[model samples]
Target: MKSKFFIKGVISILLIFLSMYLIDVFVTIPNNVSIKVNEIKYSFKGKIIEKFAVRNTEPTHLKVLIKYDSIITISPNPDLVDVAAVGDSLYKPANENYIFLSSNGNIKKFFYTKLSYETRSNKNFPREWRNKWLDSSMWDSSKEIN
Candidate 1:
């Protein structure tokens, strides 16, 4: 009887983790956003999953969220590291160095992240870091905004 209860408990925990996994796999701020770079324009739709957020999506509206580590393996040229509009703020890439992004929400979620090439398992996430609440994309700089 005790073993039965133990198995049930383990299964419950696994299920919870699995649910979180599914949310990460199927959700992100719908592609209603993008970035424009002179001659290029990038866009992601506005997507929201009631209780979850992708690192590229809005975490504020999520209950179980997964963020990933984005490390800029190739430093964008300072000249190419242009400006972006994040909500009301204009974001600029580090241009010289790179930063890291982790699929976590504890404390790393609060730290500011730079525009780095998400690698390894962090692929397919938005290219830049911006709250998806603004209905915008971090990597939407493909067209001439100027």
Candidate 2:
């Protein structure tokens, strides 16, 4: 009886580890696009994880801090600082000062930003793809950001 219980405990531990690995595989939201904020472009395809945390809300301004790993290459990485409301899985803007590019696609260039300006002098960018999420107006009732 004692041997059987010990063996079962070991099997349960292995199963727990295996399930954790599978969750990592499935829970990751794919971020495979190059986004251009102002003129400089930054791409985080298979790079940083896209977990944004919203904080410090005022009547006119809001702050968004995107959680990601240490960015070693992507210089001047844009933080989600001081913007209007940004919903998940949609370009759902809270006010007129913001826009959301679809989490899909390979390229998103921000031609306008009301918050902070990019001080980088470089004009080079990754190849621009057709903005597929430009007309995404329908919000999914089942999915939400908050």
RMSD of each: 18.3, 18.1
lDDT (Cα, tens digit) per residue for candidate 2, span 42-141 = 2222222233434464232222223344422221213222222233221223222233334344334332232111111112212232222222212223
lDDT of 1 by residue, 16-95 (tens): 99998888667742231221121022211111123322447533222111222321122222222122111111122232
Leading candidate by TM-score: 1
Question: Weakest 10 consecutive residues, lDDT, candidate 2?
Answer: 114-123
Report, for every candidate in turn, its global Cα lDDT versus the true structure.
0.29, 0.33
Instruction: Point to the candidate with the largest lDDT.
Output: 2
In candidate 1, what residue range of length 10 has the lowest lDDT sum?
38-47
- Pairs in clash, predicted candidate 2: none
